[model samples]
Target: MKRYWKYIRPYLGAFILAPILMLTEVFGEILLPRLTSMIINNGVLERNEAYIVKMGIIMVLIAVIMAIGGIGAAYYSAKASISFSTDLRKDVFHKVQEFSFKNIDDFSTGSLVTRLTNDIQQIQNVVMLTLRMMFRAPGMLIGGLIMAYLMNRQLVSILLVVIPVLVILIAIILVVAFPRFEVMQKKIDRLNSGVQEALTNVRVIKSFVRETHEEEKFKTTNRDLKEGSLNAMKVVITAMPLMMLMMNITTIAVVWYGGNLIIAGRMPVGDLTAFTIYIVQILMSLMMLSMVFLQASRAMASLKRVKEVLDTEIDLTDEQASEKSAQIAAGKVEFKNVCFQYTKGTEDLVLDHINFTANPGETIGIIGATGSGKTSLVQLIPRLYDADEGEVLVDGINVKDYSIRNLREGVGMVLQKNVLFSGTIEENLRWGNETAGMDEIILMSESAQAHGFITSFKDGYDTDLGQGGSNVSGGQKQRLCIARTLLKKPKILILDDSTSAVDTATEARIRQSFTTTLKNTTKFIIAQRIGSVEYADKIIVLDEGKIAGIGTHQELMETCEAYQEIYYSQKDREKEAGA
Candidate 1:
């Protein structure tokens, strides 16, 4: 919570001004009762009509002042709270973006979304309430007690007893409810996760006809959240009623004792009336204070949740040493005895001591059985995850020596999972190079075999794509993703089974375009289809985490048993189709 104050610092003027206005408003409220008592005892009791009119006008003037103070406080508090929340949300978003893949994996996507949206909202509400009520409530509670005592100390004795009991009740509620609020937030995170998963995989659920099963899963999570919320509410509800009973009992004692005092000529009737109003104000103030603590407890829980993400140190940071390495020519990659494991104490290595190199203008193909570490090997070149041992070099320098932006810019990759945003075809293409002209977009789209379909649309380049490119076919989405990568015209292009969705004719055309249009760019192709890599300058076959063979397709077919098996399997499938 203290860490979040950096965002509030910019709006300090508003934060300070609001409390000042609120204090003035509380002063006005405290003064009004005293004025009422004077009017009753001096003017009304004497039946002086002139005095009554004068007091009435004074009361109206005070009321107007109070209204102005309230408005000023509200305006300042609202401005500060909203500005603080906006800055906080933006900071959290940027921090999340800077997080490494490992850091991102530590928190689920849905949980991050919850922290960004729901958790921030909870904190903002608490800040707003605190600004508006925190100072006012305390002033009212203390001021009301002092006024009541001064009016008639004999009746004020009830408060000394009542206040302690109310404090104890609030303390007990906080002790029990604070822990539950934290648990309730966790339950909300789980519920959000369930909803996000259902929405992301809605198509799979429909295809499997598992709507009923999904609904049951969602209901179970929803019920957990409901139970947690209700339990917290029940505790809060129990405390409020008990608090009201205590306040009412105190009020009754004050009235009964004061009436006897007035009858016995020990106290004035006007004083007794003022004392009752003071007692009511004190109780209301205490109630407001109790509610503030309750809300603050919940906000504390949300604050901790948001801080977790913000405090996460980015595992990958640009190194000063990387600056000298950027001067080297791009597309010179080297893997020297590289090894990797996702977690500590894991015996399995995703990539073993593998040595390889691909120079400028050269194409390298990686062929492997499922789980053979092909993707993991390439991921190291960009420093997505540092190798546990050995070095990954780009442009003849250790990748860690290059700035993250420079390293990524030099190497453009089309991931195995093709992703497209909700935008026009041209807008998606611009993601690769924001300043790319229309001619560049057309040339790149055509090279990736996506231009034809894009032009086929009524709006051509301006056609809006649905979220995740749901409006297009899988093949079209893959081509659009490829074109997006091509627009960058990166020095080293990595295609991780990017052409798997396209037909053989389209795939061949893309390959031809790469040889022609992308003559200067070094390409790393990871493909399961043997035909996809047959034309590569060199093909490396991976078995488990080690390199089984490294050569052209014809060389691997004859020299490597694993490669021979893959070749024969592909040939056999083609023969069956021919027959």
Candidate 2:
């Protein structure tokens, strides 16, 4: 509630004015029935022509005023609601941006998208309804009942039965509708997830000829969404018909009783006519009130979902760092007695009892069999995931001590899966250092061995990439990513099998450039191919999340069994290829 007020406070004027203006419309509406009763009783029945003209003109003027008020109400309500949702959407998006990997893992991609869009939209709708109806509905109900009393006091008895029944029906509908709406929102998340996955991996789906499989998955989610929506709306749908039935019954009863009163000369015909319309207006206002409550109930479900994201405690934050000004320099990295798990309080550790040190300017190679915790080890350096047991240090300071931005800015990493946004090639490369000039951009591209193919494109550096760089080959994508990271010129660099798609000749050229141009940068090379990391200053071989060996090529060849096995297997493969 407090968090939402921040957004509301800015547009408080519009919020307050909307309902206030609506009262003018409601006031005019209430007076119309009373004015009609007078026009009939004093003018038509008594045969007074000027009196009829005067009252009719007054009614028209009141209607004109009512229309102006309604237009003003609508304008303010729309302004308040749109502005409120815009700010709320922005904050929700910012909060998601601040979420740690673990916090993000707790909510799926599709769920976040729904919360940012559909959930906030629901809240906005409620705000618009509330702003318009807050005063209008109640004003009409109270004014209508009062005028009805003046017209015929005996007619008020009918409301005692009708109001309570409609209120009870509305309450029952809301109670059932709220939970179903929540379930419906979750179904929307599934639908969105299915669609996003299919579109993003459409290439994979086509290559494997699994379009039918994807369609089936979409159909299941789509069907679930349809059923969920119907369940939610079903109760809300019942409200209108039940209210209309009661409305008709109450109208008939009022006319039946009031008609008798007119025949007995206890009430005037104009009074009976006015009384019937007042009953309808009163019932209509109740219906409007019920609609407002129903919408509010649905918006509450969305609010809860939105709150989950806003209230999420990001497990990773640098708020308590001792050295706020700490920055990474010299690039010395060490892991001491480090233990980790993707899930905490579990015996199944991803990396166990890990211990290693890489001095500044040394090229450290990390080779491991699949699922040997290669990526997990390097991720700790940037504090992507905190160590469950021990500390990860950079330049002698705990990685946690340095601010995340400071530590990350000094360490550049190219993960196994390369990602590129939809933009020109030059715009993509500038992500490393936005201030970098064209000369620096070309220099890094040459070092990554990407300049050759990049220039061959018609637009060269200005060539626009498709989403996720789909237009480029796998090898070209890797080289572009390499160049992008290189432009950072960080003290520490990690290339996690980033060159796997590039041929050995180009890969070697990139590595060679590192020694000459980036001699001072400590580089961590993670690869499956032995030759990729064979000539490093130090090679660390991992097996089942443990360091099997840590030494240069010849040193590991003699001392480590795991290292010997890997070397012989690769040498045999090379021999076969040679033949």
lDDT of 2 by residue, 491-575 (tens): 9999999999989999899999999878999999999888899899999999999999999999999999999999899999999
> Model 2: how far is 415 from its true place, Å?
1.7
Alpha-carbon TM-score of each model against the true structure: 0.97, 0.98
Candidate 2 colliding pairs: none
Tens digit per residue, CA lDDT, model 1, 358-467: 88988899999999999988888877888999988877788888888888888889999999998888889999999998998899999999999999999999999977
- Give Cα-based local distance difference scores for all models: 0.88, 0.93
The 10 consecutive residues of candidate 2 with the worst lDDT sum are 148-157
lDDT of 2 at 367: 89
Q: What TM-score should be assigned to candidate 2?
A: 0.98
Q: Using lDDT as the measure, which candidate wins?
A: 2
What 10-residue stretch in candidate 1 is worst by lDDT? 319-328
